[model samples]
Each structure stands twice: as structure tokens, then as C-alpha cells.
Target: MATWPRREYFYYFTKMMPTGFTLTVDLDVTATKEWLAARDLKFNAAYLYLVSKVIAQTPEFRVYRDNTGQLQRFDVIHPAYSVMHADDHSISSLWTAYDPDFTQFYQNYLADLAEYGDQRTPMPKAPQSENTYMIGSIPWTHFTSYTPLPFTPLNTFFPVIQAGKFEQEAKRWQMPLSLTIHHAVADGYHVSQFFEQLQLAFDHPEAWLAS
Candidate 1:
């Protein structure tokens, strides 16, 4: 009989998800520039990639269950955003969870994380997801509201925006982003890193997006 030299489940503890860790961040910026630019959609596309990539790599964005949990880092993320197509405004998403290129991810992630590090963490980062939410399409209008906060439901935001109450509601919800990260591959600092990186990116949008 031949003996196999390797075991498959030796370090199985690192594959579990963490709980009780979710994070929220509030980004305050005006889409006024994005709206005016002929490539406003282009700007939004770049912004989404820049933001999602960072969230995927930073360990802090990952949610950790309480102590005594098994499994390691999950190494994934999910992104939610609104889009437009077919001449109709819609909301869409691209899940960043389980991206294979983490090194490049970190490079992008770090760039944006450095920016909003000064803000507060409203919630712990949630666990990483294997799923994603994709909204359809969107069209520019005088009532377009692009804010970065309020873990409030999407429906709530939409109606309010159309009601011409975007600014008021934005102030009310405090405009903080909420996320859940899988605990298999990261800790809490990654979330903090994410915001910090974002601040850096917004501050230097040109250089940040060029990379």
C-alpha cells in the first residue's frame, strides 16, 4: 500500500466566518462635478471600482464572529450601487466578494482607504458575501441624489430623492455606509483602512483613478 503524504483539512479552523462585526462609513461629496462632466457615468464607474476594491481587501471590512470561532479569513466582498440603461434610471450592483486578485486589490483598496480614515465607524464590518446585488440603470436629472450614508433601505432613499428631500434626508441619515465582511481572512482594521483609503482617493481623485 502507498501512503499519501498530505492532509486536506489540517488547518480547517481558518475557513469559518465571524459574527457581530459590521462597519458603516459616511462619505460626503457632491456629484455636481460628476454631473457636469460629459463622462459623468465614467466618473461613477471609476468611483465604484475604486471604492469596492478597497472594501474587498481591507481585513477590517471583514466581520469576525465572537471569540471561540473556527475558520480563517474568507477573502471576499460585495458591492451595491445604482446604474442606468435603456433610457430608464435603475439601480444595480457588482459583488466584489471573492475577487481572486487580492494584491492588486489591496493596492487599489489602500489608495482609497487612506482618505476617510478620519471619520467614525458606525457599525462593524459584516462578513464577506458570496452573493451580490445589481441594480439596473439610472438617468441624470435635477433631482439626482448621490449620497454616501444612511444604511436606510434603498426604497426609502429613492422616494425621498424624487420628493426633493435628498439634502434633508442625507443630513438625517448621517450618510454612513454599512458593510458585513466574512471573517475567514481579515480582522477589524481593514474597515478602518478602507475609509482612510477613500479619503485619500477623494482628495486626489485624478491620481487615484488613473492608477
Candidate 2:
């Protein structure tokens, strides 16, 4: 805490003046979609896996405070997302433990989806872990920008990621990606780096996605 680099900045943002920002960018996912389609994989699951992998690899996105009110960073962050029910369009919140291996994580995601995807309850399918962050998708529409309004204060530093509907533009498939992050834990530079890595992952699915 005393030697932490962003201690003062964190205090200023969390206590003095809370601030958070949301940035939405278009990601080229043409190759990713093609890769998934060839294998008959769900786009939503693949997108979530990529985003979770990026976040877990970035330390700035994994910062959180413990129960004793001490700031800390998780070694990895899991994805907590909503599953829509077909009957009334209600959503069920679910989370899965993140695995570095794509195959393992995808299997875990399928297992959770199978057991709890249809449940209309607000409770998560599995016990939500403290190291988890929110990730979601809006496949029905495309948008340039989106903001998330969480009940917690601005210091809730873990990022919330959302992907909009993908559309074909010229020769590429582009999707809107909105990222909301706490300023206390990261800066615009860190955000840019995260997006760069994310886009790289999208462009090179063969690198991470198990064939």
C-alpha cells in the first residue's frame, strides 16, 4: 500500500473525486467469425473467452479491494455474464471459473450454460467469486457507444465489457466494443494497450482458439 505506485491516485479518485470513463471502439472480427463458423461454435461464447483472456492477462484490469479495505490485484479475473431466457426474455446471471486454456474454459462455459442457462432466477449458476468481472453482449443491435451504470461507486475498478452486434462493412466484419473502467486503477494508455491486445486476439484467433 505504502509503496504502491498509484496509491495517491487511487485515493484521490476513490475518495476525493470519483471518476470513471467508458470508451467504445469498433473491432474487426471477420477472421474470428470465420474461425468459429467453421467449427460450429457460438459467437457469444468465443467473444467472452477472448475478452476474459485479455482481461486476465492485463494486470491493470484486475485491481480490487479486499474485505479489510486494502487494495489488491487478482492474479486472474473470471467472467460474470447474463444468459437470456427465451420464454419472457428474462436474464439469468451466471459466472464460470476462467481457465487459461481455451478448450477447458469453453467446456466450462458449456457446462454452466447447460445446467443454468434456462433458469430464470437472479442467482448465479455457480458461486460468484471475488475475482470476477462483468462481461456481456447485445447481439440484436449495433451501437457506437454504451455506458454501464453500476450501483457501486466509481472505485469499482474491475472493467465491464460489452459487445454489440456485428455487421459487415465493405469486406470486414466489425463489432462495437464498449469498455468501462475505473480511472483510479488505470489510465488511457493502459486502456489503449488493452484494446490493442484485444484487437490482436480478434485478428489472430488461431493463436488462442483451440483448433
Candidate 3:
């Protein structure tokens, strides 16, 4: 623990009353959406792909302690997101294993969506992957602020991501994205770094979205 960069912050925050905070920002996704539209790709899958790619590259988001009480960083973190069922207006949790290769990951996402997207059960994939984090969308509303609280707060440290409806202005599309993070694992600076990279990814779809 001596050389761990977040040692002090982790201890201080987790020992306090509240240990996490959520920040929402509007990200311009004009180029990304255009690219997806041209390719006839699902925006939700692409969003999860881009977001998880950035999360894997950011070390702070990958930090967690193991069952043995040893601090460890996951080599990659997968996305466990919500899939809405059109039939009965229900939502089920689905997860796709993270693959750094965008093509492979997108294919995996499509396969999962095809199989379990319409399932009647709440959690089709029960006992989700240990190295997965939450990512979902609220397509019905464009929320300016959102907070997602875990039932067992201190027991989790992974980041929770939520996206709101995207609306286009004169020349650009803006999507409200909220990121909830444990203060022990990250601060505003770290969160800003992640958002900055994410915005860049959204702005330049050709960089990583090309098939």
C-alpha cells in the first residue's frame, strides 16, 4: 500500500459519511452518430463500445480490491448494461465481455442483444461478471442531473454510467452523460480526464469506429 497512489484518498473517503459523487456533462456526439447512421449500426452498442474502450484505457476506473483484500486493477472492465423489452415495457440486465478490438466487441454486443434483449426476466444474466461495471441509458428524457445509488454503497467501487437522450442543436448533437464514481477511487481531476478522452472519441469516430 506504500506505493499506491490512491492509498490516502481511498482510506479517507471510504471512512467518511459519503464516499461517492455523480457528475453530469453534455458530450457532443455529432460525428459519432453520423458514422453509426452511415453504417446502420445501433447507437447503444456503439456507445457502450466507445465508453468501455476509454474506461479500459483509464487506470483509475479499473481499480478494485480483490477478495483477498489486495488492491488490484482489472486488465479490462466489461459493460453490464440495461436492455429494454418492447413487449411488456421491462428492462433486463445484459453483459458483453470486453474485447479491445472494436469489431469483435460490437459483434459480441449484437449477439447478446439478439439473444436476451427481449427476455421477460429482470436479470437474464444473473450474477454478472465480477469485472463488469454498469452502463445504461434513459432514452425517454434528457436529464440535466442524475444520481444512481447502489443498494450496498461501500461494497462497490466501480463507476456507474448513465446516458440521456441526445438532441441536436444548430450544428451539433449533445448527450447528457452522468458518471458516478467512488471518491476513494477517483476525484474530479480523474473524472475530467476520462470525460475529455470520451469526448475526443465521440468527436472522431473514424479513429476507433471504423470497421
Candidate 4:
């Protein structure tokens, strides 16, 4: 666990707003589809890979408070996402460690699906860790706005991310991405940086997918 500098304003600001905040934006994912189609890749795997890769670059996204009330930044973070079961029409939450390598991440996601995809009941909650981010997707709808459940007073700093259905228009695809973060750990500047990085990843998937 790494603490923020005492001089940083966020160090004091987070103490007051412990529950955090969120932001939602729509993004062009045309290049993402093209890149995946050229390589015969699964959209969900590629999309999550890009999202996780971009998130790994932002330190503020990995901030969390310890039991003792000290803010800590993790060197790495993983994704804990919701997976729907086809057998029972239920959702199961699963967690997988993050890896920069797209192939490894995709394979791990597949493994997780195989293990929990058919379960009728929810899987056990993932272990609490400073190095985890919450993620989910609603593939059936293309929404303009989204709001997640309210956060408790001591909610962890892990960012919650949701991706809506992608729509095709004039040979291009677009998707809505909603991100909720703790205001104490991140502000508009940090959220803007995250969106910029995510767009770059979507615009140039070949750069990261090749490796």
C-alpha cells in the first residue's frame, strides 16, 4: 500500500467525500470492431482488454482506503465484472487478475466463463483487495445515461465501470461507457485523462493487440 503525498489536496479532500462520484460518456468504437474483425477476436475480450490496459496506466484509479483509514495506491489492479449465465438467466460476479498481454487476459476470461457461466447461483464474492475495479455491461441496450447504486459511507475507491450496447451507424460503431470513481481519489482531470486514454486504445487496438 502506497500513501499519497501529504501535500496533495486530494489527501484532505477524500477525507470529507468518502463515498466518491461518477461520470458517463459515449465513445466511438468503430476502430475497435474493425481491428477485432481483422483478427477474428471476440468483442467482449478485446473490449475488456483495452479498458483494463488503459486503467492500469492511471494510478488514481487504483486508490483505496485501508481499514485504518489511510489512503493507499496499488501498483496493479484487476477487474471484478458481472457475467450472465445462459442456463438460468442469472448474473454471476467474477474477478480476474489483470495482465497487459491481451492473449493472456482473454484466455483467463474464457476460463472464468467456463467455470461460472452455467452456475445457477451467484459465485462467492471476490476477495477484498485494494487492487480491484468493478465492471459490468448491458449489451441489450444503448443508453444515453446511467447511474449505479448508491455507495455507502466507507465504500472502497475501486472505480465502477459499465459498457452499454454498441450501435452501428454509417459503417461505424459507438458505445456508452459509464465510470464511477471516488471523488477523493480522482477529479475531473483524472477522469478526462482516463477517457482520453480509453479512446486512444479504441482508435489504435493494433498497437496493443499485436503484443
Top of the candidates by lDDT:
3
Name the lDDT of candidate 2. 0.87
In model 3, how large is the Cα lDDT of residue 40? 90
Q: Estimate each model's TM-score.
A: 0.40, 0.96, 0.95, 0.88
Q: Per-residue alpha-carbon lDDT of model 4 for 139-198, expressed as tens digits?
A: 999987777886366446767899999988787888999998767667889899999989
Cα displacement (angstroms), candidate 3, residue 198, comes to 0.4
TM-score computed on alpha carbons, candidate 2 = 0.96
lDDT order, best first, reads 3, 2, 4, 1
Q: What order do you get sorting by TM-score, best first?
A: 2, 3, 4, 1
| Superior by TM-score: candidate 2 or candidate 3 | 2
lDDT of 3 at 62: 84
Error of 3 at 100 (Å): 1.3
Q: Choose the strongest candidate by TM-score.
A: 2
Residue range 1-211, candidate 3, lDDT tens digits: 6899778888888776457889999999999999999989889888999999999888889877777877788888899998877777888899999887788999999988888887878778666788999899998889999998577634447799999999888889999999999888899998999999999999999988876
The 0-to-1 C-alpha lDDT of every candidate, in the order given, reads 0.37, 0.87, 0.88, 0.78
Error of 4 at 169 (Å): 2.5
Root mean square deviation (Cα) for candidate 4: 2.5
